[model samples]
Target: MWRQVALEAFPDAGIREPIGASALAEAELRLGRSLPTELKQLLLESNGVIGRTHVDTVWTVDQIVEQNLFFWSDESLARLYMSFDAFLFFGDNGGGDQFAFVQKPERADVFVWEHESDSRRWVANDLRDYLGRSLSAGGDDWYQ
Candidate 1:
């Protein structure tokens, strides 16, 4: 699903093989959050990092913060970084509902539209569906 999303969203994007456990540990240290085990396993077992070869993209939460892109550090926000053209972090809503900070609010406005409430309600499930929709929407035109 992640590969499909990368292909559909960027088409020309390059995929990086999973980083090793040592690197992941370092990243966790920088991020200050223990990555969910499932998420860590997913990254370890797949070409998890996706980005355009010509563009400067960072995957680690620390990199996101160092670049002042912490608003894009959450899993859902990461999906936006993967699939959209631009984004910015919006202020946090307590009770754990944090929105992305988007450069163009209109683009960010469609997050819930593309993925239903339940679709965006969970990280792993939401990530899967997001990638699936991106690929499905692009259709066969994307695969070649």
Candidate 2:
């Protein structure tokens, strides 16, 4: 799903795997926001890249840290970035809702997508579309 999204969003860019748990916990500690359970589960389940890519890529928490892609502290800032990167591409379907937050001290950026919604609206069913669009907008160069 993510791969498809990446292809659509960034046909020229490459998609990678999901980051690891320990890294996620560290990011959470740094950001001071507990990730939503549903989002966590999806990342865990996905294990590797959730989007499309021409080259095989693996997204580990360590890689994110090494690349220095920390979360933003300001909610509004985080919301803006996520809105542009993740949500806008995915659209507000009835599948789930995804959001981004930053770790407190470290300020690492973290993405969370809620699987269930009160209104029964799916936010990220089309993983390919969401990831493709998100990645297309310079996300591939995020780690650089």
Candidate 3:
């Protein structure tokens, strides 16, 4: 379903193979949080997709954890960089900005972590809504 939505919404997207359950589990273990169901379903259909306008790529599960740690631990970055304790980083905008699933106990929404402002803003209700918005967004206007 996610694959179909992706292809239908963005025909030029580069899709990769689905990842195994163990790999997903390992990522969750490393992050110490469970993956969102919508994201898991999307990954199970296709590990990641590339070639979006605003977002360069939807990172694979392993890359999600790695990128999260890289941002969380990089002291050289702006002091405004947020801790990974509160979000599950998942995708990148090719810029320093990141897309994540909000991990707060009451909210499991999707947000964009702006690199320049070091601020986060809710962008979608969940993974499905995010994919729909970003994929259908005609150009970089999605960012603004």
Candidate 4:
């Protein structure tokens, strides 16, 4: 179903092998927060989803853990921008902008973290909406 949904949005969407339950547990443990339910299910369906222009429309578990940890802990980033603690980053725009879920409020909405200005803005209502919008838009700056 996940693959079908992705393919419907972008015919050439790339689907990867799903990660194991243990990997999901570790990702949540390391991130110190449970992933949004839809995201967890999607990750189990495919570890990642690659969209237009080879962009990481949905990143693998490892990348998700690493990126979130870096964003949450980097001191330089702390000093340069607003806190990242409220967000859980999972994918990139092929440039620098990233996609994230609001972990603090625990909502299903997906937002884009504009790297340059450190701005967070709503782009899609939920994970499925995000996949549809990002994958079908066929452009790096789809949210823009």
TM-score: which candidate is best? 4
Per residue, candidate 2 scores C-alpha lDDT tens digits across 58-127 of 2334433332333223465455443222221111112233333322332223443443321122222333
Give lDDT per model, in order: 0.39, 0.38, 0.75, 0.92
**How do the candidates rank by lDDT, highest first?**
4, 3, 1, 2
Each prediction's TM-score against the native? 0.39, 0.31, 0.86, 0.97
**TM-score of candidate 3 relative to the true fold:** 0.86
Q: Which ten residues in a row have the lowest lDDT in candidate 1?
A: 89-98
Question: What is the lDDT for 84 in model 3?
Answer: 54
lDDT of 1 by residue, 1-144 (tens): 455455666666555666688876876676454554534554564434333333222133333334333443456756654442243222111223322323343321313212223232221133444334333343321111
Tell me how candidate 2 scores on lDDT. 0.38
**Candidate 3 deviant stretches above 4 angstroms:** 53-55
Ranking by TM-score: 4, 3, 1, 2
Model 3 poorest 10 in a row by lDDT: 76-85
> Which model scores highest in lDDT?
4
> In candidate 1, how many Å is residue 79 off?
24
Residue 13 of model 4 has an lDDT of 96
lDDT, candidate 3, at 115? 73
lDDT of 3 by residue, 31-117 (tens): 767888888888888998775763555788878878777766777653555565677788766767778887766365888888777
Clashing pairs in 1: 87-102, 88-101, 88-102, 89-100, 89-101, 90-100, 90-101
